[model samples]
Target: MKVSAKLFIVGSNSSSSTRNAVDMACSVLGVAQLDSVIIASPPIEDGVNLSLEHLQPYWEELENLVQSKKIVAIGTSDLDKTQLEQLYQWAQVKPNSNQVNLASCCVMPPDLTAFAKQFDIQLLTHNDPKELLSEASFQEALQESIPDIQAHEWVPLWLLRYSVIVKSRGIIKSKGYILQAKRRGS
Candidate 1:
């Protein structure tokens, strides 16, 4: 049976990222407790890499929400077999699912498929990449719509997945985009 409500939130991470999540949810949709959270940190960033060490804290926070009955499930995004395996072995709550970006390599990686089967973790797909929007690219798009806004100074902060359970309003139901900004050229 459906428990209270299931709120799915997917986003990139940083030191105070989880706090950003709660604030965004509360501000936009009044969501107090999130259900399923999909971690969307790109598997590779510059020289940074995905390791059990990097992912543990995020999963642990999700796990805390699950244990506290604030959330029901937790998931990952774009992680491959080796990475998924390491996370599965180490995570206290164990990821309920792993999302594969269809654009990353088209067909799901064979090894990832095999691993998901063995573990019973659902393998899902998404079109959005970790860099869903880039600084320059978003600015370019915005320039066409609103010329006065300084595209150069604006930077995308985070993206979240939230569903408005209330059907009464029946319009512009759900989504998340909270941007953090910093000036360039100090």
Candidate 2:
């Protein structure tokens, strides 16, 4: 069996969310360690706009999980060559892979391809939207599900997506999403 998870850090606030997401995923999947965890951060500007300062803490948190044996490998989503290079140079646990959004780029940039090849980093493709879940959409879902006025004040902080697979059979056994939210004022 193998378990893979993806953490989407919503908005600009992802301080401790990475660790919390991984811990919650581990608990939910009944596993001590996830086979892989890919982080998808909110888009800042464009391919050149990924901020290292903002990403450093999240990467550090994942590195801690790696050191503690809570995660086997960690990767990132939608980073260009410059951004990936900056992250790779600074990260304690270098990214093992990077996911490119095919919806945005029909062909992978040559520089990014060369860098990945040089570093032996796997280049994967995905079709996830730039914003996986928006605050307004989250509030709408909350209102629909809870039918409470207070649902409007809640803000989604992050989303964790997990998939458990039967490795031997190459089939998915289970998959689900876990969302974390907070009140507007708090």
Q: Best lDDT goes to which candidate?
A: 2
lDDT digits (tens) for residues 55-167 of candidate 2: 78889999999999999999998889998999999988999999999997999999999999999899999998878898899989889888856877888888998999999
lDDT, candidate 2, equals 0.89
Per-residue C-alpha lDDT of model 1 across residues 143-168, encoded as one tens digit per residue? 77789887777655554555544345
Q: Whole-model Cα lDDT per candidate?
A: 0.64, 0.89
Whole-model lDDT, model 1: 0.64
lDDT score, candidate 1, position 46: 66
| Clash count of each predicted structure | 0, 0
